[model samples]
Target: MEGLYIEPTETSPKVHFDPEAFSFEISGESRPEDVRKFYKPVLDWFEQYSNYLYWLTEKYAEGEKKLVQFHFVFEYFNSSSAKYIMDVIAKLGDIQKASPNAKIQILWHYDEPDEDMKEAGEEFETITNIPFKYIINPD
Candidate 1:
């Protein structure tokens, strides 16, 4: 399945999802005027990928596990963006639950000295049981 890659804009974040590597990242601020339009494709891509992965695993019948790693780093996101973020996390959680044998990591990166960002990461971590890695990126 093809992955979705969106370039970052002044009012949005960069989205990189590579099914080959099973790695994904969304970083930067996300407060686009049309939040639904901005996030619909992302949500759709995740659903498609999840289904593809499941099908591939079933067809291969391999004992080896497939893992997906997601990284989220946002400087500032509006309320609309926040809901999308939650939706993304929920989808990831569902995937993880379905594939108990697989490993999924959700890393939250924040700028060093940005207390608000750090706290936001913590809050997200609390809401979801998905394993989270809080990273402090240095300038």
Candidate 2:
């Protein structure tokens, strides 16, 4: 199945989800004027991806496990964006729950001295019960 990619804007983030490469990332500031409209497609892509993952698991029961990396790098985001961000993570959590053979790694990248971002990642880790690898970026 094909993946999803969206260019970033001043008040939005860049989203790149490559299924074949098993790499996904959402980066940049997010405060889109219409939060729901901006995030709806992203959420939809994950639903489709979930279905695709299901097919792969059913078809390749004996195949090797798949390792998928999801990176969340945000410089800033508003509360509305945060809600959709959590929704995205929830979708991922759902994927993880449904597919045991697929290893989903969540990587949270934050700039140096940004304790809020780090703490946000930690909160998500706790809420979703999904492990996250925190990467500190130089300011």
Q: Pick the candidate with the highest lDDT.
A: 2
Model 2: how far residue 20 lies from native, Å: 1.5
Candidate 2, residues 1-139, lDDT tens digits: the string is 8889899999999999898877799999999999999999999999899878877765556766788889999999998888888888988999988887788899999988999999998988888788999999866
Model 1 misses residue 117 by how many Å?
Answer: 1.0
Off by over 4 Å in 2: 59-63
Worst 10 residues of 2 by lDDT: 55-64
Model 2 TM-score (2 dp) = 0.92
What's each prediction's TM-score?
A: 0.88, 0.92
Q: In candidate 1, what are the lDDT values of residues 17-127, reduced to their tens digit?
A: 988877788989899999999999999887887777666665444577665679897888987888788888888888776665566788888888888888877776778
User: Which of the numbered candidates is closest to the native, going by highest TM-score?
Assistant: 2
- Candidate 2 yields a Cα-based lDDT of 0.89
